[model samples]
Structure formats: C-alpha cells, structure tokens
Target: MKRSEQNVVARSSLPWNHSCGSKSFAATMSTKAEIPHFVDFFKESHWSKKKDDWLDHKCMEKHGELENLRTMCSQPDAIPMSQEEMSVAVLGKKSGYLRGYGVGRKPCNTNTTSRDNGEEVIILREELSSLKELNDTQQQQLEAQNEQLAIQQQQIKAQNQKLEKFQEVLLRCGLLSSDECGEESTEGG
Candidate 1:
C-alpha cells in the first residue's frame, strides 16, 4: 500500500483519543484540480454517487474538508454562522461517505425516488416474503386437491364396474329382459 493509504489504515485502527478532537473528512474535490477518482472512491467507500453530484463547495467547507484551504482564503459570506448550527446543517446534508444535499439540491441520492430507499428495501423484502409464503400454501393446496380428485376418480371407476356386473347378472337370470338392459323399449300393439 502507498504511504497515504497506510496512514489512513493506521489512523482507522488506532484507538479513539478523546483529546484528538474532530475528524477530518476527505472532500470530493481537492484544490489544483486533481482528477477525481469516482470509481475508486466508490470502490473504497462502497457507496456510489453520480459524477456531477460528487462535489459541492458549501458542503466541502462546512464539513471541514476544505478547512486547511479555508484558513488561507477570505470568507465568502458576511453572515457569521454558529459552529453548532453549521455542524447540524453539515450533518443533515452529509451522508455516510457519500455527500448529502438539502431541498432543491441537484442530483439527490439516486437510491430514493420520493422516500427513504432503505425503508423501501425493507418493505419490498416483507412483501416478497409474504408472496413466497402464499405461493407455498397454494402449491400445497393444489397437491391435496389433486390427490383427492384421483381418489374420487378411482372410486367412481369401481362403482361403474360393479353396476355393469350387476346388470349382466340380472340379464342372465332373465330378471331383466334384453329390452331393459339399455335397449330401446317398444310396446307391442
């Protein structure tokens, strides 16, 4: 691994230090126009975002990603914002690894259409589970119904054979005449 990557690993593995103060979040863009490695970012962070939405100047400054640069540059806005307020706004706008944006922000999280994508995933999983359960039940019922129909068919076949034998015996004993054995019955004048 590169020295910078090793440093990152070291920092991550090191125990938490209360005195170490705040964390430094990496900005999507760096000064001097360094080519953004979006694919690399996503691969490393395991989060995806569009190329256009990767960078936002306000968010960079708010999240302290541009803090070092900010110290050297003049304040862009005259309105002084409280640290707490800035932190809250930044948190609300920032997502894990990927950037967060407020209302009217362009390129909103691709994962969500009108609601939380995470919630949508959960709901879909539940619906799928219910559908699977229903399918299993229907399949079981179908098998049972088929078995019952087969048994009924067998019983009917046996009853038909028994009735044929009984008719044949009656005919042989002259109890039922040939005309009564399903032949056309015509009355003599």
Candidate 2:
C-alpha cells in the first residue's frame, strides 16, 4: 500500500483504537496547511482540549509527524508555524482552551477579588478569637489582683486595731507618767 493510503487507513481505523487516536490525528493534521479542513475539524472536536497529558503528548508527536511530512514534501513555506512561534502560541492558548472546554464545567463569574475576600474573612475570624482569649485572660488576672488587694487591706486593719489596744494599755498601766502621757497626748494630737 502507498504510504499516504496507509496513513489515511490508519487514521480512519483510529476511531476503534482508543481515546488518544483522535488527538493524534488532530496533531498530525495541524502542520499541514493543505489540509485546513481536517485541521479545523480536529480543533473543533470536543476531545481536542481534554486534560489528558498522555493524549496531548501523543498529539504533539503526531504533529511532529506532520512536520516531517511537510519537510519530505519540500513545502517549507507551507509550515503553519515556526517552533518558537508554535510554542509561544500553544502556551498562550492553553489556559484559555483549558478554561473553556478542557475543564468540563461552566465558567463562573468568580474572580481574584472574591478569593481574597474569603481569605480576609478567615483572618478576621482568627483575630477575633485571639482578642476574645486575651480579654478573658486579662479579666482573670484582674480578679486575682483584686483578691490580693483585699487580703492586704484586711492585714492593715488588724494592725491598726492592735496598735490602738497597746496604746490604751500603756496609758492604763501608768507606765507613761502623767507628764509623759500629757506630752504623748499633745504629740498624738
């Protein structure tokens, strides 16, 4: 069989092979400017933008084959893109492609601002909890300090009462002479 006929047959039979088969064909057709219809068909297919890295690799490999075919056919100007250009284009387009059909979900209106707001809420909750804990600790310390102050005040009151009784005894025993007591009273006054 001719090489071209063999390639066509192989491509046709690929539907029964595996999921990677369609991707491989798409990649193979990507380099051929002469086969724009096939290229468009592959690009528009739902399976083209799947998240399967193995399939992507196989597709890339088949694209290399298309380049080889172009080289063999001596149609240098028919090349779709230079290696550098293709790489840049592929990288640039991949994000959009994945976001569109590759992710298999409807694109929502979520943005970076919403994500930042979520993080801010979490931070604020943590800060509030910490402040509450600090306030509780301060209240406990204040209670402890107030208890200590009460104990000290009771000690001072007892000491004052003892001093007053000792002074009365001294005066009653006459240990302080009248003149001395008189002087003491004057000093006390």
Candidate 3:
C-alpha cells in the first residue's frame, strides 16, 4: 500500500477521544477541498462506544470504493456549481442555518463524466418524455374522478326527484299533511 493509504489505515485503527473538547474529524476536514475517507471519519470518535455492528463492518469494507468516488467527484473536470447550490447540497435547503455558515465553506465537487452533447440531450429528452407520460396518467385519473363525481351528482338529483314524487303521492292520499311532508300549505284562508 502507498504511504498515505497506510497512514489512513493506521489512523482508522487508533482510538478516538470523545471528550467535549475534541472536535469531530468532519468538522476539522470540512474546509479542506479533499474529501476524507469514510473510515477516517466514521471509525473515529463518533460511534466508537458502540459495538462494531453489521453496518459499520459493511461501510468499512467499502471505504476504498467510497474514496474512489470522492476522488472522481473532486477531479478538475467536474462540473462547477453556484454558491447557493453548493450550500443547499452541503447543509440541505431546509436547514435553518444560512448558506455556507454552519460548516466551513468547502464546496462539494460534482462528478461530470464526458458525454456527447447529442447523447446527453437524447437522455434528457427521454426523461422529459417519461415525466410527461406520468403527468398525462395523473391528469387522466383526475378526469376520471371528476366524471365519477358528476355521475354521482346526477344520481343524487334523480333520487331526490323520486323522493319528492313519493312525498307528493303520500300527501294526495291523505297519508301525509303538508306539515308532515316538510312543506307549508300554500292555500290562503
């Protein structure tokens, strides 16, 4: 293994001080442009008190892969983002803290592998087409619900008409008075 890799491995094995005075590895390294290895951060003081769980073991096994991804993302050819975008990505937009305030203003690097412009456009078009199809399906479902609502309204109107007819018939047969049928007698004395 390379000297730096060996150093990182050695650091990962070291016991971390979890006292109040101790700053987290993430807090210390946040300002630096280089992304630290996952093992370096997670293996340190944070969860040292707990048993080495399955998740920790799994993450440790894949730390190298995570480091590789970080390296790829931080490459010079990666896409540039606005300060606001970087802040949102790092702190999350919903967080109450102002942009680039809580953490040191280290911007996240975006991974942008080379792709043909035409191919990229085609991929975006395909995604847009899929979204349109989803919107159309939702619209169709809404229209169906509206149609059902209209049909229900018509059915209720018909039922009300039948009930009115029944009430009129009962009134004529003397089984129901105008008061009993919830109607005022219109005839004047």
Candidate 4:
C-alpha cells in the first residue's frame, strides 16, 4: 500500500476509530463528505439547538416578569421596593449580589482554616457597625421629631388658653352665651 494509504490504515486501526469498520473506513476515505470536529458537529446538532432554545425561553420569561414589575412600580398606588429586594426578585436567592460579594474583592481561598474564620468575623463586624450607624441615625431623627411634636403641643395649648380667655371676654360683653362657649370648647377639644 502507498504511504498515505498506510497512514490511513494505521489511523483507522486506533481503538477509538474501530466503530468505522474496515469497509466503512474505506468508504469514508473515498467519500468527499467532510468529517467535522466534535465541537463543531455538536454545535450544529439538535441537542445544542434545544439548549439554546431553552435558555432563550428562560431569559424571555425573566424579562417579562421584570417588565411587569416595572409597570407595577409606575402605578401610583404601588409600594416602593428597595434595591436589595428588587435585586433578590430579579436575580435568584443564590446570586452573590444580594450578599454584597464578588465586587472588587478576591475570592476567599485562604490556606488556613483560621484565616477563613477571621475573614467571616471581620465581615460580620462590618455589618454590625453599619447597622449600629443606621440605628443611631434613626434615633437622632426620632428625637428631633419628638422635640418638634412637643413644641407643637405647647403651641396648641397656648392657643386654646387664648381662645378660652377670649370666650370669657365675649361672655362678659354678652357677645356669646355661656352655653355657646361651652359647646365651642367641647367641639375644639
């Protein structure tokens, strides 16, 4: 046999190519049909098309849900959603975005077990500090509101006292009857 034929025979004799069989191998060598690489072949095959279609359907479904959420938000009576809640709704629970991970930080691949524990502790401490800061801010705002409310109450009391004195003067001048004054006071209260 010629060298090229000999090479073909040797190649076809390999364990993986045994499925071709001798006659089919000869026919394959004679045929003009190209043998595709596995990856390229799979790319054009049914399974690949099925997978792509499935993925596209999932993306469309998610897009539709997001559109609905946007529409709901545009409505006047819609409750406001926080960024974290929106992200969790759009992305699944397992997404790292909700946990504030994988952005400008290295993956936790420490050699020592203690190092991992230390990193976790640091993260917890940071979260705790942030929560404490929020609590302090809310407390300060509540105190301010309370102070304003107390001042308002005092002003209202002063206005009521002035109204009472004016009513007494009206009574002395016979402008308003005592029954009318009493009724006005009751209504105001």
Best by lDDT: 4
Q: Model 2 over residues 1-189: C-alpha lDDT tens digits?
A: 999999998768642223434354435445457645322332334234566333445445544554554455456556454332343343234433321122321234244446757987999999999999999999999999999999999988887677657767887897766577566556754
Candidates 2 and 3: which is better by TM-score?
Answer: 3
How big is the positional error of residue 178 in model 3, measured in Å on the Cα after superposition? 1.4
Q: List the residue pairs that clash in candidate 1.
A: 93-100
Error of 2 at 43 (Å): 37
Q: Runs in model 1 with CA error above 4 Å?
A: 1-103, 106-115, 183-189
Candidate 4 accuracy as TM-score: 0.42
Candidate 2 TM-score, C-alpha based: 0.37
Ordered from best to worst TM-score, the candidate numbers read 4, 1, 3, 2
Between candidates 1 and 3, which one is better according to TM-score?
A: 1
RMSD of each: 18.1, 19.9, 15.4, 16.5
lDDT of 1 by residue, 40-113 (tens): 32222222244533233443343353343323333675444433233334444433333321123234544344
TM-score: which candidate is best?
A: 4
Clash totals for all candidate models:
1, 0, 0, 0
Candidate 4's residue-wise lDDT over 1-189, tens digit each?
899999999877632222233444224333537854222221222123434542234444544555566567668999855433443576445534331111221244224436857887999999999999999999999999999999999999999999999999999999999999999999998
TM accuracy, model 1: 0.39
**Reference-based TM-score of each model:** 0.39, 0.37, 0.38, 0.42
